[model samples]
Target: MSYELQALIGPAELVAVAAAEVPAARPRLLAQGLALIPATPEFLAAFRVGDEATAAPAAAVSPSGTAASAGFDWFPGGLERRLAAWSKAGPIACVEADYFGGTGTQRAAVWADGRLDLGPITSAELEPFPPEGSPISRALRRLGARVTEGDDAVRDEFDAVGLGAHRATVSWVSAG
Candidate 1:
């Protein structure tokens, strides 16, 4: 009985699991979050989004139980709210020298029965382009940032590069 978790990365990309077959939502959501972080900025920002936009958006997992688009922006405001919701929660506090769109804000989402949701992401919208050669990564590369992927279990070292800096590693545990 596993459910998919769709995490919003940057403004455009959505690291989503379209009905992955996991045993529980917590590990699956957390794993999906780490797995979905765009290794590069272009991946960070891909696809277009419309805030206040509405449609029957599926929560990342497709009807066929597969990752719906390498990312899912299937609904309107679908992408923006995801990012905004997480930011607003304050549980996922993010403070960085550089962030996408030059700034960020936060709010809250409702969760129940082992499912979590946040949205109508406060003015949260997609970046409108792919995150290729983004300002943040390009700078980090110049500073010789030792980047790697996997090992998402270690919170403090799996952060992504955005805005003007790399995340100072994260240590997160789901309340679920």
Candidate 2:
């Protein structure tokens, strides 16, 4: 199987703010009480502020106000400034992962309290995992996703948060 995702994870209120900026944001609830808004093609088209595909995706707001927006391009200009503004209310994590044919790459960055907190971390195939773990894992931790410690069957932050339920970003749109 192969998996690829690009997303922003953060407080539900903040994520909702991000979503509202877009024209047709669809928010969905996932396991672990997290909310997700996949960056479907339609969503991306509606979200663009100008030419050059400046917008990323919509957002999902959890009951607890923890949310995520998937299928984003982090390198676009002004995204960081927007995320920083949203982080004033809470922390936000930008996460990306691509895995296929036994090789993969992951990247993540976090904004909190109006500034960049952790990463723009990147890890790729054949490289050792970072001491803190993969980029997504680290970003999830910053977003309050927890792991089961001292257990025979250990689950990392990503698994604990149930992000694996969808193998692809597009799957999230039709997911129940």
Candidate 3:
């Protein structure tokens, strides 16, 4: 099954905390890391398409599965972590999280310090919005980051197990 989460935070400082806190729990809890994506929109988009040629394949998933030929799983939480930091520097149009797998798919989008117009979203009618003054929403704004919706990366690693995105965690090491 797929799993996704998104949040927005502000005032800068807390971004680091969220980065360390959110992703750290997941991969460590599952004992499996996820594929890493760069913070830039272009890179993020290329990652979705499994277009390593254009994007930085820093810690990319292998074609086979989560187990890199070298035996390491790239952490998926990096994107979230990066956004947490990036947003602190400027006003981001949006923040998002996404996951797509054979069993299911998940996506989240968020906006902080501004109102979100749900009319344009893909599943806007079916989507849920955080109420104003809600603790979570407030906390995120205070932290300088907010979670939001987005789409899942393309399924590249067909041999992956469990969640599809997990497959992108796979890597292959070259031996000299």
Candidate 4:
């Protein structure tokens, strides 16, 4: 199976703030009781109201009580400011992954306390299981995803969080 996703993951309350601001935002649930708000195409269009150059929509997830928001302009001035504002509550991660038949690229960045805490880290398509501290792994760790003992199949924070449950951002919307 292939996977394609772009999202912001952070605290549930902070994510709710993002959802409330968007027009027609829908919430879904992921494994481990995480909340997900898929940034449907409509919502992305609304989020880009003032900034036409925005690349994606905004989404968030939390650690204790996770939340996922799919599709955000991962790195744009306006969105960065907004993410900084949201980070006042806690860390927020912008993660993008696209794997065609289990081989593709992944990258992520994190904001916390109004600052860029982690990456802008990128992983090559050939390195599916990036070593510790890789972009997505670090970002997921920042968001509180953890590896359990003796789970050989679940290698990193990404697997720990069960993000592969959905194939795309639109799937999240349809599931909602």
The candidate scoring highest on lDDT is: 2
lDDT of each: 0.27, 0.67, 0.29, 0.66
Model 3 Cα lDDT, one tens digit per residue, 1-176: 44333323233233344334443211211101211221233333422344443233424533332112121222232332344345445432222234455332222233233332111122222345344422223333333333333414322111121122232221110100
Residue-level lDDT tens digits of model 4 in 1-176: 88888776776666787778765667565444445566456654554567654443333321121122322234333456577787888787777878897688877878889877876677887875545756777887887777899989887777777776789978877765
Model 4: how far residue 53 lies from native, Å: 7.4
**Backbone clash tally (model 2):** 2
C-alpha lDDT (0 to 100) for residue 14 of candidate 2: 66
lDDT of 3 at 42: 30
Two-way lDDT contest, 2 vs 3, winner? 2
Tens-digit per-residue lDDT, 85-153, candidate 1: 443422221111223444432222222122233222222233332243322233223223334557463
Q: In model 2, what lDDT does residue 173 have? A: 66
**Model 3 worst lDDT run, 10 consecutive residues:** 25-34
Give the per-residue Cα lDDT of candidate 3 at 35. Answer: 19
Q: Model 1 lDDT vs. the true structure?
A: 0.27
After superposition, the stretches of candidate 2 with alpha carbons farther than 4 Å from their true spots are: 31-33, 45-47, 51-74, 150-154
- What tens digits encode model 2's per-residue C-alpha lDDT throughout 1-176? 79987666775666777778765656656444455566566665543457443443323221121222322343443455567787888888877788997688887878898877887677868787857788888988888877877854546777877778788877776674
